[model samples]
Target: MTNKKKTTIKDIASVLNISAAAVSKALHNDSRISDKTKIAVRQVAKNLNYQPNHLASALRSGKSNLVGVIVPKTNSNFFSSVIENIEQVLNKEGYNIIITQSNESFKKECDSIDTLLFTQVDGIIASMANETTDLVYFKKIKKNGIPLILFDRGENNLNVDYVGIDDYASSSLIVEHLVNQGCKRIAHIGGYKRTRIFNNRIRGYVDALNKFNLPLDKELLIESSLTIEDGRAKMQQLLALKNKPDAVYVAGDYAALGAQQVLLENNIKIPQEIALVGFGNEPFTAMLTPSISSINQHSDEIGKKAAEAFLVHAKNSSFTQTLNKIILNAELIIRDSSNKKNQ
Candidate 1:
């Protein structure tokens, strides 16, 4: 097969025997260009298989209809759902999304930002990885007039646009729900490093226990990476303790699932003996034998809101700020795992 050269706007202009500027105006649907001319230009552009040069177009209009989206990991269900919603919003707005995953690596996250900068994306929407700390890279972008919006995982210091649920409040609600169910001795699992999300969750857990006059037992605290294996390992350790906790608050559903599997394998009864609560209402959370109680952060809504923020900021290139902070609400999903009678 003969490799054909990529068609450019100039090719469409030549095919139409018109000025490049006219073709550009038609592509942008400028009112100056009549509807008849716009149709003609579009038809020629399509026939030539012409694709506009985004960089040159950006240079001409001083705006790029490209948004960069960086997420910790594309493999997670929640992140995947968020990205899907974000893309839908941006697509409808006549914008393209440049997506990359950092895989929870700080260095990779930094590199991803660098690449987006080089691409000259009009705006950036990101969820920082677990290992990210120095947000100075993002700060420099905003300093240079690039719009940055953070959703999900974020840096507290950067005062750019951010949209997410109050982590501490949601965590408190979940822990309080478990405690209200008569879970006197409870344990927690799957807190990663020193990220604000996990830290706030820890605070919520501590605050809830203190409110209920439950002693913060050292044996009940199990910190592990949020993963299936880690959850299973932590759950095993919790089970081995001289005093096993009566209830567990897990950070992620996948880990919660792994822990549940261990409990079942040991013939431990759920809720009746050991109650459980989980975060991130992943698909499997509802499908399991005992539905998993979780804090619903509305992953898709987070993504859509993030995209909307990016678009709003992109429109106001001259310091036209839209929303500073949009804190969505999280719902506590009560399920069989946490409700004894429901089981």
Candidate 2:
């Protein structure tokens, strides 16, 4: 069996009885080419199943027209939606995305950045890994003069464009809802304080408890990576306490799911024995036995804003000195787990 030769501009030129250069200009929609020739070139190119050489075009134009997107993980609906929106916005502007996942590993995140750079992407949009703390690797991106936009899990000290929700306000909203449900001894299963968003949530949780005149017990405030396993361990620790919390607010939905599993295994009634809530209104939160109350992060908006931020830099040759910090308000989604009235 013989491999078919890939169709080229020369093939279209031969079919249309025009110069290869004419075909090239027509394919690119160059102003020098006539409309009739351009239409003829496109029709023949389609017939031949011609594929444009993007790499060659990038080499000639000095712009790859490719964007890199790095996320901690892509399995969650929130990240998935964000990515979808980012692609949608970028695609309209004739740019494509190269996606990479860090799996919450700092080394892996660094590797992803390196790989994206190697690919000669026009810009990068990323959400930092949970294990990411060192800014040197992130600083490298800026050092290269590539546009870098961070969303959700980002470091402010890096001084780049960032798009995320008001995590502190979201946490306060969750606490207020729980307090309204008659929860006094509210516990928090939160992410690490080193992460900006988690730190904000922790601060909000503490302040909201104070605002409502509830006991701000140090024993009840525990920090972890906010993974499902972390949630299970933290929830177990909370359950073993002599004075158990009347409510538990987990910083992540996966962690909240783990906490709910532990509660079910122990035959503890949800909302009655202990109300439960989670962050990032994941779809599974509503599908649980007692639907988990959560905070909506507005992933679509974040994705769009992040992509737009990158475009702001991409369109302008001169970099903007002012950093874009888009902080959107999050909404509380009440469900059976935390809504005592509904329960």
Candidate 3:
């Protein structure tokens, strides 16, 4: 079987007995081209099964209409929800997205950035990896003159557009609730201090403890990768202490689950013996045997705002000069793990 010739502007022009330029203008609905000519050209193009070369068109317009999104991981409900909302908003604006996951690896994040740049995306929206301390890779995105918007996991040092929840306030809320429950010796299983959000949460936790006139015990404050395995290790470390904490607050839901597993394995009662709280309000937080208390980061709102931030920069071309920061308040969802009063 022989290959069929692809239809082009000349093919439509030949059918209409018009110049190829006129056919091109008509297909694009240029104001100079008559509506009658446009109608005829479109009908002929459809009959010829003409498919527009979007890449060529995009090159001519200097816009791909494609955005790249990077996230640490997608298995978590929070990141997945954020991605869903980002796609919904961008699709409505005639833009498409390419999503990439870093799996919390810095090298993987750098590779994702390189891949997105290679694709010539109009803009990028990202949530940084746990190990992304160096901002050099992010600077490469800025040097390319494309808008970069970050969410959930970001650094102020990048000085680009960002949308996220008030992590500091969320931590404070957890401390206040635990304080009200008469937890004097509280422990914190938090993320690495290198990450901005986790640093803010650490600061908030420390200040909240001070505000309540509680002792700032260094042993109780452990910086981790925020993985479930690390959470179990940290929790075990806490349990080995002669003076164990009465309550524990974890920086992530998965880590909190790991801590819960350790507590249960040791026959320690939840909420009664050791209260617990986690951040990000993952669905499983409420599904466990002893439902975990967590902070609601408003994943949908964060996603929408992050997409909108990228749009603003893409339209205005001002991300290089004017930085946009949108921080939403977080809500604490009280549950069985931290509700000592009910227990």
Candidate 4:
């Protein structure tokens, strides 16, 4: 059996009765080429199943026209939505994106950076993993002079472009809303303090409690990985306390869902007995039986800003080192879970 040869631009040029250079220019949408010839070249390329040699193009032009995006998890609606918007903005500029999930692993994130670099990607936009405390691997990207942008879970130490919502203010908003609903003894189930965003949320929760003249009860503030299982376990622990909290504020929606499940299993009436609020306005938050109250992080806006930041860096040779931080304000979405007065 004979193996088939791969289709190339030359094949498309031959079929369209045009020079290979003209076909290349047409593929790139050069203004010098007539629209008629460009359309013909594209049609013939499609018919011949011709694939452009991106690696060769990158070597010749010093640009891969490819962007790398790293997220903690792609399964979540927030990350997936952000990725979609990023793709939309980048694709219009004739750039493609490669998405990689770290699954909250430091080693995996490092591996992903190495892989993207090996592929000669023009830039990398990433949200740091939960386990990524060391910034050595991140520094390597800068050392190689590749444009690096961090979003959501970012580090202040790294002077790179960043785009994310104001997590600290979001936490304060949640606390204020719960207080308005007459929740005095509010407990918080938040992410680990080592992560910057989680640390900000924890500080906001503490400050809000103090501002309301509520005691800073050590028993009421717990830190975890913020998974659904962690939420269930943390909620159970809160329930076992001698004086249980009247309300719970979770740092993540998935964990909040788990807490709600535990509450349902225990036959506890929501808002009436124990109010709840979650961060990250996931779709399921509103679709649940007694819809959950959550904070909208504006994933779409964050994605767009991140993509635009990459484009700016790619276009300007000297702008990579310039610090550009875009912080968006998050809005709170009220629902049945925490609406005590409406109940």
User: Ten consecutive residues with minimal summed lDDT in candidate 1?
Assistant: 314-323
Candidate 4 residue 156 C-alpha distance from true site, Å: 2.6
- TM-score for candidate 4: 0.91
lDDT of 2 by residue, 1-343 (tens): 6979989888888998999999998887899999999999999999999998888889989899999999999999999999999999999999999999999999999999999999999999999999988988888889888999999999578788999999999888999998888888999999999999999999999999999988789999999777888899999999999999989999999999999999999999999999999999999999989999999999999999999999989999698535678999999999999877874
lDDT per residue as tens, model 4, 105-183: 9999999999999988999999999999999988999999999999999856889998998888888999998899888
TM-score-better candidate, 2 vs 3: 2
Q: Per-prediction TM-score, please?
A: 0.91, 0.95, 0.93, 0.91
Candidate 3 deviates by what RMSD? 2.0
Q: After superposition, how far is residue 228 of candidate 1 from its true place, in Å?
A: 0.9
- Give the whole-model CA lDDT for all candidates, comma-separated: 0.85, 0.92, 0.93, 0.93
Once fitted onto the true fold, the runs of candidate 2 whose alpha carbons sit more than 4 angstroms away are 14-17
Please provide, for model 1 over 1-343, each residue's C-alpha lDDT reduced to its tens digit, 9 standing for 90 to 100. Answer: 6989988877888887888889888998999998988999988888887876777768978777888999988887899999999999999998989999998888998899899988888889999888777877877777767888988788476788888888778777877887788889989885774877888788888888888899999888778787899889999999999888999999888889999999999999998789988898988899998888888889989999999988776666666443488889888889999998665
Error of 1 at 70 (Å): 1.3
